[model samples]
Target chain A: MKRARIRWHILVFLTPAVLVYTAVMMFPLFNTLRLALYTRIDQERVFVGLDNFRTLFFDPIWADQFWNALGNNFWFFVIHMLVQNPIGIALAALLSHPRLRFAVLYRSAIFIPTILSFVIVGFAWKLILSPIWGIAPDMLDWIGLKSLYAPWLGKEEYALTTLALVSVWQFVGIPMMLIYAALITIPDEILEAGEVDGITGLSAFWKIKLPLILPSIGIISILTFVGNFNAFDLIYAAQGALAGPDYSTDILGTFMYRTFFGFQLQLGDPHMGSAIASGMFIVILIGVCIYLFGIQTRMRRYQM
Target chain B: MNKARANPYNTAAMHGALILYTLIALFPVFVIIINSFKDRRSIFREPLALPNSESFSLIGYETVFTQGDFFLYFQNSMIVTVASLFFVLLFGAMAAFALAEYRFKGNLLMGLYLALGIMIPIRIGTVAILDMMVATGLVNTLWALILVYTAQGLPLAIFILSEFMRQVSDDLKNAARIDGLSEYAIFLKLVLPLVRPAMATVAVFNMIPIWNDLWFPLILAPAEETKTLTLGSQVFIGQFVTDWNAVLSALSMAILPVLTLYVIFSRQLIRGITSGAVK
Candidate 1:
């Protein structure tokens, strides 16, 4: 009877949040996914089953832009995975070093960017990279690499990669923090045990610390995957809604924004925007599911 | 001492890497900040130099104050951020209490439902959300930003708070129940105070992103009257790209408050993260 009463209390307590969140977040996400299935014709919304998906896939106009944005989004995720996680891991390893002085200062300095508005970072980088201002060129000249300087944010080739690197700079602190926490969790006795076995410094980290933190690394990888795919603000701030010079920096988030809202000569198409959002949702879901089921289970077994 | 000093190789490498990465992390801000105190010509002539009598000028500050309404934008951002944080915390805590303390049929399902917001991007529903906002005539208002941000923040707030609350000892609530404390009384008197740490963590998590975001401000509230510091600075810098001093100062203006707050709370923020509050 007492257990039953507690369950009742739990239900009453959980209802409001769950209800509101479901109505607002999950419902809309899935609704967007459902809305993607149907197409609108002459102002009437119709259930065309997979026609929108087909159009997103096979239609000439969208197929080009859609695949381009999708490919950019994938590359964007790849850059984060390749750059952010490794830097985060390296920082975390350095931070976890017992001999380091002012570890707190280093951690905070590294994390300062993550705390600022992306608008600030994006715009600041844009200003710093502006050719007219010549800060980048001047800085490069000081290092005797003046020829290497270009307005990377303005260039068609370098814009997306530049933005991705900026994002990595901002968010790498997260994985660092997570991995640091995981490092702190391992028993001191294990490290002592390793030392006793003549594995004192670098080998101690490589053998003991790295294995213990694999789970945290896996978690950070998935978080980066989801975040990079949904990213919009920095690109929007740096490149605007056109995501140009000729849509060079277009990622899924900006693509969805441009499609849904319409800019310049393009008409706003809610159905198509929903279609793109649904595509992002599907991609994110696939990444998340794979991480949770595949990587996590394997990591857990390794952890034990 | 002899052994340790003999093996300077690894220690030197470790310190070398840390110093290099720290410089990489800090140099951009350092360069901008130090140069902001210099004259326009001095800014470019010796961008790397610390400002002395030869480099110092207040022209940027003069231009920023005379040519811009920075204070107004800062005020707007503060209002939107604080208001959103307030709603997200109060209602989020309330809903978290409901989930943690109750046992309805769909209780587990409901908790999962709330937590799902963390996984999905709220930007997916931009079309409907904007349509609804306009239909209600909230476009260009700070209230529109608040409502949208609150909706965006509440899910993760509830999820984190609920996890913290469940760890609150069952004995506390059971004792309150036996003593005839009402559910609301138990929550207000017993629960709210205990969860202050969690509340702080949630506030910190939501505050930075909401303050920094450009998408919502750009889409829903782009008017001069409603511009946040971020949108304001982006425009300011874009227009004044040639004015190095003004651009750097404008960037400084955006960085100062958050940098101040971050330095003060970084220890607690680190504690909050390593404590698994965010997870």
Candidate 2:
């Protein structure tokens, strides 16, 4: 057999991306995980061996904030999964209707928010929902539903949900577009087949189309899961790093931010921040693993 | 299709629902843009109304221009985003070409290693990244933002690009090889052009996030000189929160560029998404 020549060009092609990604992303991530197992004591870095994790999970003060943020993060994810995905799927279905008018205009318009920066979306909603100058109250009044209006972003009970909904408003286009893509790809023959079987219109969708798009939905669900757990910019932009209304809107991202770079009177603790990041990594990993091992394996991906 | 045509009432409801959601999506943005042009008082009084001659004022924009380094912030954002996009596309394409064209040992492992960052966010490593930045003196520089964004963008770019690259006709590349065209030549001259649409998809996907990212800019490069448009608007808006005119104008200013670009590229972007580039 002839000796195979070493493809130096392949290495040359791959080196830049690999080097940059490793140095900037992978190395930092592993270092962060390592940092989580260490702590600074008296200005000296010392290995604490999961003490930070213990503090984050078991210590009363740290545990309270940690759990609150985790719970809020889950709620954020839930809102997205429950409200955003369904609405997105519905809008996509509506848009995909063969006779739907102005479908292009509607999709483009609805997707406008998705392209805007979170700073823009966050502050835009903050103003629109402001108690004083906000038009939410006025709009409600015009509709004779003034009693339904409140400073939703200011009230503790409503803050996180309001932010989550705002986030949904910005990102619903994602699922919609993804699902829409999946919908349009469904062969006409299949729908015609469904119609022949008396599964037309809404019934057709519920029975035939929905099953085929379950894989797309699964992908969207996992994307939403990852996005929601890592969400920070909206809350930070709207409510500041405090994630206020007494931290009702805080999530793992903000919690990590605050701990990594202390806010107000609290001193920054990198160790605890890494610990939080690790916790988030675990949560996200668990979610992804469940999807991969538990859910994805069971879903049937239709070839068509 | 016939069922949809037969149900006129259903069609009406579908249009109605779509129109309603469309309004809901565009309303806040519309209000902000209009209000930004009006005097602060009109902004409060007729927040929903269009700007009339009597209500029109440029003071908000004037305030925004004078109070912050809006131009500098814009320049910084442009530099970072464009530079990051350039590196991401180039490096990502090169890497994708290798994986697609060359059958090598550990290729699967290499693919998986590169793809790891797709599901796991780059933000989790901010602690050590910041530390490394500080150590290397890249903190508070555009370089820091660019490097971070390049890393952030590469995984998805490589993944998408490789998928497209695989579909490029092997016959063309083999013929080119027979012609004594170097591998690099084939990649640069042939493969890159073939994958332009996917490159656009990757670019569009990464562009918005990089331009709009507030976290890394806030943490890694929060200095006055290195402030991105997103961070600048954020800090500017935070300070001028009580000033509705300035805030609205600042926001509108922040929004106008992105909105304009989006309008221009909206078709391409939507097409990119629905084209299954991501799937």
Candidate 3:
């Protein structure tokens, strides 16, 4: 009777949150996946299982845009993996050095961008790089490389890469903070032990600290993958929903937005939007599951 | 201690790389903020210099205040962020406490279901959610942002709160229960106070993204009366594209408040993250 009473209280307390989260999140999520299976017919939806997917994959018009965005999304993730994580890790390493000067100031300054709204950062960069303003050219001129300045955001070849770099600039502090936290968790005695073994400085960081923080690095990697694949705001803010200079900067997030909400000539397509959302959900889930089951297990096996 | 000559090379290298990167990270903000206080000619001529007596001007800020509803947008963001933070923490903590303290049937399953949202972005439900909002006529209102952010924030809120709530002293709670206090009274008076620190941590975590988000504001509540600071500034900056003064000022108006808050709370914020409040 006492045990049952305890269980009843737990049920009563938990019921509301579970119910609300379920009613709002679970039902809609499943409904989205379900909606993706069907197509609109005369503004009347018809259940066409897997036909949307078939069209998305095999149809030429949809296929070209779909594959282009997918490939760009992959490249986006790759750039972040190559650029953001390494820079973040390097910064974290520097900040974590013992008795570092003005560490807090450096950290807060570096992290201000991460806290900034994407709208602010995106527009700030757009204005700073504007040729009319000549801020970019002037700065390059100061460094004796004014010739290097170009309308990067306006060029098809450089637009996506430039935007990706801007994103890296804004959010590098996330992985920096995460890895810094992980680094602080490492016992100082371990590092001292490495010193006793004649391994110090750069060598010790590689042979000792790197191994200890692999799990954290793994966590940051998966988070980056999920985040980059779902990115839209910066692009949308910097280059509107059409993601111009000729859709060269288009990724899945902006594409999904444009598809869902008509931009200029396009009509809003709820069914196709849901299909695109379903695709994003699958991609994120695959990355997360791989982290949870695959990478994490390996991380533990190699744990110090 | 006397080996300055020995280690000077690496130390110089470390300082060089760090200071360079820090400048790269912060120079844009520096440029915008400085230029926001300068005449257009001065801004174009000297982007790097601090505003001296001759250079300092409020032209940009004058335009920002006169042309845009800066205060109203700030108020909307505050209302939405604060309101969502309240419901998310209260409901989330209560639910987290129960899940952590009890070993009921399907407890693990319930936890995993809540965990699902942590991986999946809530924006995926935009189609149905927008449909419901439109049907209910809640779009273009602050309440829509409140509800969407509540739903969006609750999952991680629950996850983080649950992790913290589990560590609350069972002995203290049991003693309170033995004193003939009802569960509701015990929770309201005792457990709530105890978990305030953890809730603060979760609040900081939830606060940043909600304040910084641009998508939901653009999609759900882009009315003149309802635009958030983010969306409002984005639109304002876009309109003033040719007016560098207005654009820089608008950007400063958005960034300065957040920067001030960050510098004030930097330590607490970092502490909150490293406190294992979520873990």
Candidate 4:
């Protein structure tokens, strides 16, 4: 009887969370994956195994859009990996300096943008970059670079890159804070030891601090990959559901949203939407598996 | 280690770099908020300048208040955010306590299953989620948003809270056990107080995304009464795309509450991150 009471208590504690989570998150995720394997025909939901996948790959109309969005998504991830992470590291390094004045002020100021919604970030950037307003142009003119100004967000050549840079501007704080946290955890004795051996200032950071924080950098990179791949709100808010300027800014997130919901003319197709979602799931799964098995395992051995 | 070796020139350069980036981070927000107070012509002509008596106008605010149901949107957002956060904390804490305090069967597996949500984006299940919501008659209801946000917020909350719970000094728990305190009481009266700071950290972490989320709100609850400030502003701005004043005002209205809350809680927020709570 006493053991039964203890077991009941445990169940009581776990039940609400488990039930809610299972019903809302886990079940829906798996169901969506299952839905990917089936299609509908003439008002009847039919189980078609991998036919949708084949259509997505071989069907020219679907293939073109999928490949385009996938390519753009990869480019988005690349910009974040290349530009966002390095700048984040540089800022974190600079801010983590021992004698830096107003460090907290700088950290807070830099992080303020991160908490704002993508709607705000997207619209704010849209207005600033609008050539009609001349804010960006006028500012550039002050630096004798007025000729450099163009309607970047409207042009097919620069639209995605512009949006990516704006995203970087908004989110650079996350990696900075994460890396700063890791940088501060390095033991002072390690830095002192390096100092005693003629490592100081720049070399102290390069030779001592950077290596210790590599694991944190790895974690941040994986996070960036996951976040970049799943990103939708910014593009949707800035360029609308069409990811406009002829879909130059379309990524997997927007593509899936459009396919799932159906834009003005296109009919909503859940089966194809699920297929695209499943494709995203596979790509993300591959990226995560590579990180876990490939990067983290090697980093673990190096840590000791 | 002397003051001279600190390199005054290097310090100046570092400050310059930080100051420049800080401007880049804050300047856009600054421009929007200031321009919201200006008349249309001035908004374009003196976009970079601060508002003066001649330039200042309440027309934008008047338009936002008149043309949009901002108050209802704000209340809707508040209800959804607060309700979801309450459940996320209560349920997340209970689950975290159970996972941390017990060594029962499937403990590790359960933990790993919960942790999977951390890496995977919940948005991938949009199609099924919408279908389930529609089937359950939850579509276009705040409950749909509340339920979804709770699920979205729980995994991270449990992960962080459980990690903190494991450090709650076994001696205290043991003494409470010896004192004839029931397990639930021990959790409520003792453990809850102990992990309150971690809970606060979790709350802050969960609160921003829940409040700012546009995807779920746009998908699950786009009804007039159910519109969140984020979605409402998105639609409002999209409709009034040519109205510079209303657009800037709408953007500023969205920016203010979040920015104000951020400023108030920024100390705790930064402490949470820098204290290695996140890492």
Best by the DockQ measure: 2
Question: Judged by lDDT, which candidate is best?
Answer: 2
> Model 1 Cα displacement at B21 (Å)?
1.2
DockQ-based class of model 1: medium
Per-residue accuracy of model 2 over A53-144 as CA lDDT, tens digit each: 99999999999999999999999999999999999999999999885678999999999999999999999999999988868998899899
What does fnat come to for each candidate? 0.56, 0.89, 0.59, 0.81
Model 1, global lDDT: 0.82
Counting clashing residue pairs in each candidate, in order, gives 16, 0, 0, 0
| Residue-level lDDT tens digits of model 3 in B1-279 | 123223767767777888888898888898888999998889888877899999999998899899999999999988999998888887788888877877778889888888888878888878777776788899999988888887777889889878877878999989998999987787789888988877888888888789888988988899999999888899998898888889999999999778876777677788886665543
Candidate 3: stretches off by over 4 Å: A1-8, A301-304, B1-6
Per-residue CA lDDT of model 4 for A24-126, tens digit only, reads: 9989999999999998899999999999999999899999889989999999999999999999999999999887899999999999989999999999999
Tens-place lDDT per residue, model 4, B1-279, is 435338989999999999999999999999999999999989988898899999999798899999999999999999999999999999999999999998899999999988889888899888999999999999999999999999999999999999999999999999999999999999999999999999888888888999999999999999998999999999999999999999999999999899988988898888898888866
By the TM-score metric, which is better: model 2 or model 3?
2
Docking class of 2: high
lDDT of 1 by residue, A137-162 (tens): 98788899998887898889999999
Q: What are the per-residue Cα lDDT tens digits for candidate 3 across A41-152?
A: 9878899999888878789988777787888898888889999999999999988887677788788878888988898889889878988778899889988999999999
- Quote each prediction's TM-score: 0.92, 0.98, 0.95, 0.98
Tens-digit lDDT track of model 2 for B51-124: 99999999999999999999999999999999999999999999999999899999999999999999999999
> Model 4: runs farther than 4 Å from truth?
A300-304, B1-5
